[model samples]
Target: MNWKGVLDFLKEKKFGLDRKELVEAETSPVVPDDFCAEEVVYEMNDMGEREAIERFVPPTRSTATRKPPARTKGHSRGSMVDPRTNRAITFASAHEWRCALILLASPEIAEVYDQPPAITYVDAEGKKVKHTPDYLAVSRSGKKCAIAVKPSRRVEKSGIVDTLDRIKPILGDYADDIILLTELQLTHERATNAESALQAHSCRVQADCDRVAVIMSGINGEVNAYDVAKAFGDFPRGMNAIWCLVYDGIVKLANPALMLADHPFVFRVLQATSVAA
Candidate 1:
């Protein structure tokens, strides 16, 4: 009944090694004096660090001037009221409009403004340049961002990258970051789904809050769209309510990478809020 001896014998026979060989193989290597931890260098009195910090930090001249770009006489322009901000947003191009729609439907975006201010910077040639970003956004996290929407073809020709780079230091004074978005990134199935969700935003009912809370509690964390629809007894109304909750940031799609059109859509409750609010 020596079970311990039996187990050790089996292990040694299976591995073809005794306890001495195992112990020797598991021993740690010795360290040399030359291999001691390098002394931590805290301060660098080099110009490299200074140059990098100066390049990234907002310039003092960023606040010296504020001027809007001259309006072109024949530029095609359109305007739409943002559902989230209730403000009339104007876009000079179709690309801009699509980008605006994407921003409007985003739950992360709290408020969006069109052409808030013109950023001024000096280019590589040392010429003073003024650039106006397409939109400025304030996120739910309170981070400020400036967005410029352009077609992929024009992104390089328009010097959008250089413009964003040169003006970033200046724009950093007002916004936490500057982003350049191409039409290719904004015009996608997700944008279409967001548009659909925005349309269903008005379907919220007073009882939706209680119903959603019950369904979420019942499922614990994740639930399929069909099951959620079944709980409400009316598929369209239930689906609309779910979309409304998503639009309001109450519930979030489990896989945002997948389009809402994907069958058996999965969702998770982000927060339980009174629909009456």
Candidate 2:
């Protein structure tokens, strides 16, 4: 064994020893403790800096100011299901409920919405104020209207009349018209009967309407309650169907002032020709 020759051969062969030493030297760099402390301070000062560089910074979703919701009148609120729209209509008081029923029954009315947009007006003190109307309605002729329900006494009291007078023109610009509907309009016995009739004869299907229309055409003119009921085979159903026609404008009552309880109630077909046409 030549020892000098053996050492030279091992060095020449390299034997993976030199490569392992080089890799260890490259991986383990000497880091200073003071430099590590300074890096920790930087990360503490700007915690989001790393996140900002590596990923997207989302926007802050916050409002500068908060507002409370508008308050409604403190009254005994009630709700009724409107047959025309089949929607639950809410009213602040009994007067409002009655007015809603009237609107539902009106042939002139096309649609009704509760708690319509707030109307802004300048008060008698020259201060700006907002008034939320009770009901907003569109007419058969495409006229927009705002209706305020109030008792007759309250209409004069609380300066309501004055306020409405001032707000009329303002509302008229946006609506076709604005009207104060007091108990005078809503509390009538005829109106009550009309509402009852509407409730009893709430018809939504075209088949019912077509059947009613045929009966009205056969009558060919104004007919008494008995005749109309008889034409439809005279039952609780026939009476309801007839009143439905009256409420829908397909038939017109001659004396709306008279209640349905009145004997020999008269009604004429308004849409007979139109239905034929």
Using lDDT as the measure, the top candidate is 1
TM-score of 2: 0.64
Per-model C-alpha lDDT, please?
0.64, 0.61
Worst 10 residues of 1 by lDDT: 55-64
Per candidate, the number of residue pairs that clash is 0, 0
lDDT of 2 at 203: 34
Q: Whole-model lDDT for model 1 versus the true structure?
A: 0.64
RMSD in angstroms, all models?
A: 26.1, 35.2
Which digits, one per residue and each the tens of the lDDT, describe model 1 over residues 1-277?
A: 3997886566545534344544454433323222332334434456545232222221122111233334577445666656554456777776776777777777778877888778778988999978877888888779999988888987778888988888877765689999998866876666776766666663445365447656766565667765676566555556667776777667777766556655345656545442311
Error of 1 at 256 (Å): 2.3
Candidate 2 lDDT over 1-277, as tens digits, reads 4997676446534422233433443432223222221212223235456331233222232111222233466556666655545466677777777787778787777777788778889999999998777888887678998887888877767677787789887765568777888877787665676686566454333454467667767665556664555455433445566666667667766677656554335565544332110
Q: What lDDT does candidate 1 reach at residue 201?
A: 60
Best by TM-score: 1
TM-score of each prediction: 0.66, 0.64
